[model samples]
Target chain A: MRFDKDSLWYPGIGFAVAGLLLAFGQRALNRYSQGMQRSALWVEHTYDVIRTIESLSSAVSRASANRRAYQITGEPSYILEHRHSAADAHSALAALRDLTRDSAFQQKNVLRLEDLVGARLSVMDDLLKAQARGGLDPRKSASLMARARTLDTRIHGLLTSMTRYEEGVLQLRAEEGQIGYRRTRILQYALTMASGLIILVILLRLSKEIADRQKKELDLRNSTVLMEVVIEGSSDSVFVKDAESRYLMMNTSGAKMIGRPLDGIIGKTDSELFSPETFARLKASDQEIIQSGRPKVYEYSVALPAGTKTFQSSKAPYRDPQGKIVGVIGIARDVTAQKAAEEKLQEAAQIKADFAAMVSHELRTPLTAIKLVIDMIVDRTLGPVNEEQNSALVTAQRSIDRLSRLINETLDFQKLESGKMEFRVSEADVNRLVQEVVISFEPVAKGRSITLLTNVAKDLPKVRCDKDKITQVVTNLLSNALKFTAGPITVSTAMDGSDVRVSVKDSGPGVSPEDQTRLFQSFVQLEGTRSIQGGTGLGLAISKKIIERHDGKIGIQSKVGDGATFFFTLPVDRSA
Target chain B: MSPKRRILIADDDPDILAMLSLRLLKAGYDVVKAAEGSLVLALVRETKPDLVILDYFLPNVKGDEICLQIKADSALRAIPVILLSASTAALPPETVHAIPTDDRLTKPFDISILLEKIRLLLPAESAG
Candidate 1:
């Protein structure tokens, strides 16, 4: 089973088990030592009994020797010594009995020893009484002495038996203590070994747990360092707020953004850090995000110590591990430079548009005068003009017309580029518009010896567009065809899906695939066409813009040696 | 025949004013010309011309202001106005319609078209 090292229960249970084992081992040791002590006391008791028995025997022998000496020397001091020795023997026998009381066999032997000791002492007394009557014959003394010898022999035999019995008892007690001491010693060793094993296991497990925990702590520290690096390295401001909208943590950039130090910003609420008005706005937004658990991207300008700078901040609800919204995390980018650059670019475009307008106006005034004067001259209003003079004036009028067209194209392109071109949108009939433009181009086509045809589809849908712009596009297309080729030019309109498609087809040298891509770009007159046709190249670009503004598409389809078809599609006025 | 159907023309450019006056004269209409915007209104009130052709941008006064003034005036409101502009981007067709003029034309226009617009504005019997 895998133990939860963090749980108190694992270590608690382990310590409890270890404690219980130690307690058991300690009790076993206590019992073993107690057993050893009791055994030692028993052995000492056995030894004491043996010693008393030996002393009693020795005392009896000494008393007999003293009596014999008294009988030979007939001294009073010898009799007194014999009496003392008999008393000592009697007392020793009593001590032996007392010591042997715990054992039935030893007690019986001791009692018998006591009886022997008493009889011997009485015999000695009898001898002494006989000796005291000193006038007796040798026979009488010999008989008394012989009776005493019988008693002494019996006493000696009994004392020897008692000593042997006591010795056997001491031997038995020593063997019994030896066995008890061995058993106690084995128990102590077993208990000590078991306790030691349990303690070792506990120590090993605790050390392993500590090592594992240390590794995990190291991993946590490393990841924390990595996250700190990422947050601190960012140029954009990164911050986190607490539930009360107080700053919980902020990166260096965040502190810089607020014009405050990191320590000053952390744990401080927005109200404390920002002006009251700014605080109110920031708090409301933060509260909204936290409450809704949604993210927001907004642009706001703050007056920093450096200057007023705009920031585009993206904030999301900061959720905890359980997915509860705790606060908000935000990353704010300084967009001051980007916004200023955009504004500068817009200003420059406006200035360019203004310059184009002024130039067009200045050029048009003179061109208008020249065209009016030339038209009257060509029409013979001033004076009669000769044929050659009229032809040259007509050529000049055409050149003036080209110049006017160039100015108009340049102005139109500029207006379109600046997004200032206004469209007067209305529903216009595509078929009629195509026919009108084609009819207008008829004289020019006739002069060039090219037929102008209108192949307009029947029941075509009307398109929503600026009619004048569309007319200009068609006129440009027709005039381009006339200038490029003498082949018949056909202007056709038809319904292509939900759009009205107008195509101007001419048998001109077709545009190359490479040139077709750049054809609609401003100021891009093709290589061959630039020399052959003197024109401003903004015609197709302006037409593309106009068509695109109407939510239409304009393009060309041609192959080398094949006639080119310039087509445009305007969405049908579905509202009608 | 009908007192030559007088027309008032205003332009800042002398060449434009001279050319337009000559063209209108050749087209058989009496022409009153003003090179500056400050003179056009007086000429209109004095001549009571059948039509007034105005250049949209002129010195001292803009063309729309004069048009608005002419339109505001009870006496001159009936006189037809044709505003001519050198810059079409500034005065788009919608803006032209917003101004109370009989017609609007871009500069460097065909003289025939201008003549046609004048004829349409004037009564047929008074048309040159």
Candidate 2:
């Protein structure tokens, strides 16, 4: 096992603990082995001492048997056997003395056994000496035999006690070795299990750390890849600068904008990429965005090989993870073509207005001449006219009036389009004004066989309007109503909240749903049930412009086959 | 009839100038005409017309300028001047209030309206 940092000291401590456990296990096993060795030596020593004692006792008995046989038959070979057995007993006694040197009780027992064996041997020696003299000493032999027998009995008792003590020492040594063996086994198992658990905990912690680190790194890498794709995919030039005003990142378009490679652009300041003048301006704006933590947008033009190009740049503060403003991120879009198109459109509109004014002026003078000539004929100023000639002159005059109206309306619409319409605002007696206008239109309505009805609300609130402009608006609406209508046409006015609502109801073929949508737009003629009594189609458009200038609302309401009511609301004079 | 009270009319258009002169003449007023802005003041001085009709735009001087000059002069100041223009560009309120004229009309105006405006500006005896 190795060390781990995330867990600080866990793995280090774990390994150390495991090492200690291993050392302890080794020590315990070694101690157990040594203890078993010592216990086995003790058992062997005890067995050796017991066997020595037993041999000494058995030699004494063998010597006794040989001495009795020699005494009974006086055989020389039996005498030699007795002498050899006496020697074996002395050596076995000496070995027992050495084996029991550490035990005082075993030493005392050995000494006692040795003395008794010596006395028995001496008694047999005296009898053999007497027999060796060739004299028949039965009584002396019998006496010696009796003394040996007594010594043999005491020696046998001492030998028996020493053997018993030696056998008990061997049994105790074996029991001690068995207990050491069992204790070593228990220690070994405890240490091995603890070390294994420690190692497993260390291993598990190490793998988990690795996996977590790998996953975090993987997420960061994936996000970087995704951001790169988005930045590169966009057509706008995306750029990022660090707090030090050095380029930190530039997308493909951003690099292309400067005609530089990515390597050349990154880490470079704006001064290195842009001209000195442009760089200063760009840096100032960047500083403002970064310091104020606000976004900046501006349109700029650059002279290129393909003439001048315009760009709209948007820059915002770039914040770090903690939301602290660190730099600025800029996105610039090329608007060269769009700006050019807008300029051309404005130029074309100006040209059209100039042409319309010229044409209107040119046409009005001639029309004035024609109308004057007709007026002379109608007035019978030059000469009296026949009824047929007068009637024909009236028809031409009517057509000329229509033509003049179209020219005036077209020019008015142009002036309105160019934001040049002048309005004179004042408080007016709207009710009287409407009455006077209706009275003027009565002759035309009667000649057209259309009844012109009026319903002027009494106590109608005065309104703030351009008197002439409003008059023109109402007159246009009324004329439109008269043109499409022959049935009873109603002109009404009422106080509508803060406004004066004026309406002209015409029993004409109602406008279709689709035509009503663009009814107020220029050049829209509602081809309804009424025959197309020709108009410039600019009348409604001009009227709408006038009403809007007065801060009023204009609209129409009608259904299929139902009469139409064109209404407008002029803001009342509430200042009073 | 007090020698049919005199009037002067100025217009750049030859036809409008002629027609206006004819109308005033038919109304039994001594009519004088000038097709130029400079001629109208001279005609007013020469004929001592009771009224002057000046087109807003003329050859050299503008109708409003001529009206201002006439109103400024002690001699022709009392002679009422009616200004007219062909192009429909109405003067702004500030400019319109700045200029001095008895009446203003757009061209191709009803001849009867002009007659009524003239009759209203003249003395009762001269108008009848």
Candidate 3:
């Protein structure tokens, strides 16, 4: 509703300018109209003046003809006619004088014309008196007629001057009317052009303003429709609440969430639509968003017609164009199925850990008895035996030993999976630990005619770790190497940056890259690996877990053709 | 004029008990065996053996309880009692230090090493 200064003021100035131009045009048109009217009146007056002068001239000629008739016939009717013409001539002259009353120059001509007309009348009257007295002598009458003729000629001369003067006045008045007509036409043209220009500018401005307003209104309407569509189309519930905590707007999903129509939901506070407890919780969060101007996220469980469902909702402060926080806007999504799935997975994992612990313990009980009996036989405590018997007993002892190790690995994996693996960290020499594990595997290596090489880096840094776990890791790696390789095996220790790395390399068939990726996962024995090789397939998994618990990295580096090197790196002790 | 050393063995498994006793008897010690947890204490009191070997998962009383019982009795408290278990989980702190038996051993021990440890704990008793 508010317009910027430029947008408001520019059109205002245009209208104001157009208004001024129209006013000026109106005034000029009025002036020209009046001028044309006055010129028309002047032209009429000039024609009236000329017509009166002509009437006066015709009346004087009639008077002179009647006076002469009276002189010759001594007729009273002629005298009367002469008096009537004289009276008409006198009236015409009076009208001419009245019409020229405003012009000093024309008035002078009227006075002279009047004086000649009187002189002609007096001469006619003198002759009439002489004729009435007695028939005068012929010589005396001739002289009298001669005097009248002379006066009459002077009168006609004066009439001609008056007529010519009136003609000149009429001509000049007609030319003035023509000039006024041209002046009025030019004024009208200028007014029309000026008014046209003003109207054009005004119309252009008005149309542009109208079009812009229409465009803005259309854009607003389209966006509103688009927003409504998007909000309704979404599966998540969308809503807006006012500062009073009343529902200002809600999409269909939002209304459906409340189990009400949009009309029923709008303008209602949570107290009206939800339980009192729900209202209080919602109001608190709404206030928090308005006060802090930050979004709030929370989850809640709701029991509906279907089942108990969990939803995570996020609310943010809604602001106006001036950036004043007006209300809260929010969206909520159903997470019931996902939460249920996670709980089920957690329960299954728990059952798995329990089963592993139970089976390991059960297997250990019998294993312990068998191991003890085997120990007794091998110890020669029961009786001395042949070399073959002794060897057979020792083999039984080794198998028991392997069974015990497998049980421990399962238990260890269970502990690791449950995140209950406790490490008793202590400082230990990495090189010496590697040496001990290598020596343990040496007997098996000799039986296979494989050389076991130990390359211990001088001054190899010590690391903090559970000694037994690290020993288990090295032992598994060395065992794995011995089982696979016909060529010499090298166990090496070196300082790798901040970590102390111990690696076992076997010149056996190297693991493929695809298989190496899943090598450490439980139950994922590589194709080249075997059950006859006496692997529980848990050794590498347990080793990876141990190394990770010590915050180290374990991996293999090799290709299909090259021999494989299995390595684990532990962080070097920083205290030194 | 020193008396022959006598060692007592206890386990729920009769086979384990017989095998361990035979090993100890052959190692030149008079071995008394008990297959039940309930008989260990009575036998230990009667025989006054130089050393006692008790399994943790006993039927009547646990090895730690036996250790506690022996420690409670001053006359038998000096007898070295070694508690054996199949698991390596550390004993409860109170049970580890409060009862604080002579020592503890994980089951399925190497016979030679077990003998060495026993000899070390009972230097004078086993020497004869």
Candidate 4:
């Protein structure tokens, strides 16, 4: 189990406390055992003193019995035995005195017993001498025996008293030793229990720490497995490299990308796997990421066995646990298909552009020639024309104008649909632009006997828009108005909220609601409107796209019988 | 009047050349015509026209290149050039602004507009 630097001291302190408890317990046991040994020694000392006293008493009795035997049988051997018994009594008295030295009362008793034993022996000796001196009178012998008997009784009494005193000391010592032994035993048990509890606590703590470490290890292992699964399951190539640019680890996809096995890729540098040119380029970027400790995203094409594949790879600095940048980790995705699709789309756009250019040149060139020739004849540049001829030429010129308008409308719609129309956006004075469009339509209005009027708001806020495209929209609305209605057409511009609104109100045969919905759609010429003027039907659609591109809205408000107001609004250019 | 002001016109189409020449003649300007782009520069030098009108797409060379050449020549730089193109896409406003031409026009244009451009460029001639 790994112990973090911060937590290492925890177990250390625990062991220290447990050791302290053990030391204290050992001291307590030592003190208790020493007390028990001393108590036991004192008890044995008391028993030794008692045993010496009993032996001394037995020696006195045996000497007196031997003297009596010598007096009865007049045997010299009995006298010798009596002398041996006397020597035994003297040695036993000395031993009792030595053994009782720890107690003043027992020592005094031992000395008194020794003196009485000596007196009793001396009395017996005097009787023996009297017997040796000669056969004496019965009275003299009886007196000597009585004196000896009295001394012996005194000696017996002294011995009995000494034995009783030693027995009392031994009994007191035994009780004290038992009490001390019980106290020490109880103390040792308490210390042992306390030490055991501390040890159990330490063991429990150690086990808990082990369990916690095991759980952490398990969690770490599980997370590593989960991360591996996620990386392996991804379609994108994921890899890690050391600071030296050697491959540290990689997912299966990453290995597959290099066309190598996982074992072969591991510990290998990019230089070993890629061409020198590719390796140099990749190493430069990898070193940059590592040194800068930053993330980079870039696209590169690789030559693979299948084909050249484009990849968008993002690499970031991988940091160690200490937060030091250690290496690079990267993920690369194959974007070859997406790139191919984009190339195809660009090719299609080029084709459409070429087609538009062709239409503009081939069609307009012939039309220009036709219109110029027709204009020369009608304007009398060729010759003077009669009324009939001039009328016919004028009619033909009108037809050409319509055809030209159709061509221009179709081109505008196509450009708008393909998102190729370019707008030179600028801040424009809405009122002036509307007034200019109205004036341009004046000639048409006059010929048609339609009064074209303008209601331009003064000091209207300028709007951001393409001037040419806006002018085209206004022209379309005005032309449509003049064609549909004989009543006066009013073009007005004013602020509608944050936007500048331009409306071409015409007193035309009003459109139905259904036709208004489809009015801005291309190639939808309304029923009555189609017969009145043959329009390309792309005018309104192109105008709608242009207005929308300027972040504006366009619509018409009309009723079945009432006139229609074709209006569009452009957002005011706040910057201006 | 003061030797009619000479105007050089270049176009690949014969009909366009004929119509434009007739109109310019009617409008009282001495008109010079070149059917090919290769002859326009020589024609312009020979005639020393008051102005030059060039179709953007012509045989052998483009109108903008001729206009650039005319503007490049210090002696002929003052002679105004009108670059005309049939394709709006080919001669967008930015391209026209880039080329050092006096003016530009798109084709299928009205004769009045062309006349007006010529008059603006040849203000002194028009007044006389």
Residue A259's lDDT within candidate 2 is 69
Instruction: Show the lowest summed lDDT stretch of 10 residues, model 3 chain A.
Output: A300-309
Docking class of 3: acceptable
Q: What lDDT tens digits, residue by residue, belong to model 4 across residues A267-333?
A: 9998888778778878888899999999999788877666788889899999999999989999999
Which candidate comes out best when scored by lDDT? 4
Q: Give each model's whole-structure lDDT.
A: 0.84, 0.83, 0.80, 0.85
Off by over 4 Å in 1: A1-221, A242-245, A269-293, A319-326, A527-533, A573-576, B91-94, B126-128
Evaluated on chain B only, what are the TM-scores of all the candidate structures, in order? 0.90, 0.89, 0.86, 0.90
Compute each candidate's TM-score over C-alphas.
0.69, 0.68, 0.74, 0.77
**Residues A1-576, candidate 3, lDDT per residue (tens digit)?**
445677767667766776676667667667766766776776677768878877887787788788779878878999999889889989988998999998898888789878877776776676667778876677876876787677667766766676677678767766876786687667767766776776787778877877898899899999999988999999899999999789998888877776778998899998887767767878888999999999989787765555567888899999999999999999988878888899999988877766775676567777777877888777666678889999998889878887887777777887877776676678999888989888888788788899999898998866888898899899999989877778999999998888999989999889998889989989777765675377888999999988987888999998886889999999885442
Give every candidate's TM-score on chain A: 0.62, 0.66, 0.74, 0.73
What is the interface RMSD, in angstroms, for predicted model 2?
2.3
Better of 2 and 4 by TM-score: 4
lDDT of 2 by residue, A1-576 (tens): 333565667778888999899789889999998887888788778878878877887888888789878978989999999989999999998998888899999888878877888888888777777767875477877777778777877887777777777777777777877887898989988898888888888889878977887887788899989989999999889999988779998899877766678999899998887777777877888888988899989787765444567889999999999999999899999888899999999888878777887788778777888888898889898899999999999989988888888888888888888887777678898898888789989998988888998999999877777888888988999989988877989999998888899999999888777878889998878774235468888889999988887778999998867988999988875442
Residue runs of model 3 more than 4 Å from their true location after superposition:
A1-26, A71-73, A76-94, A101-341, A423-436, A439-449, A454-471, A493-502, A526-532, A545-553, A569-576, B1-128
Give the Å shift of residue A557 in candidate 2.
3.4
Best by DockQ: 4
lDDT of 1 by residue, A297-365 (tens): 978877778888899989999999999999999999999999999999988887897789889999999
What local lDDT does model 4 show for residue A273?
Answer: 81
Question: DockQ order of candidates, best first?
Answer: 4, 1, 2, 3
Worst 10 residues of 4 chain A by lDDT: A7-16
Answer with 1 or 3, whichever has the higher TM-score. Answer: 3
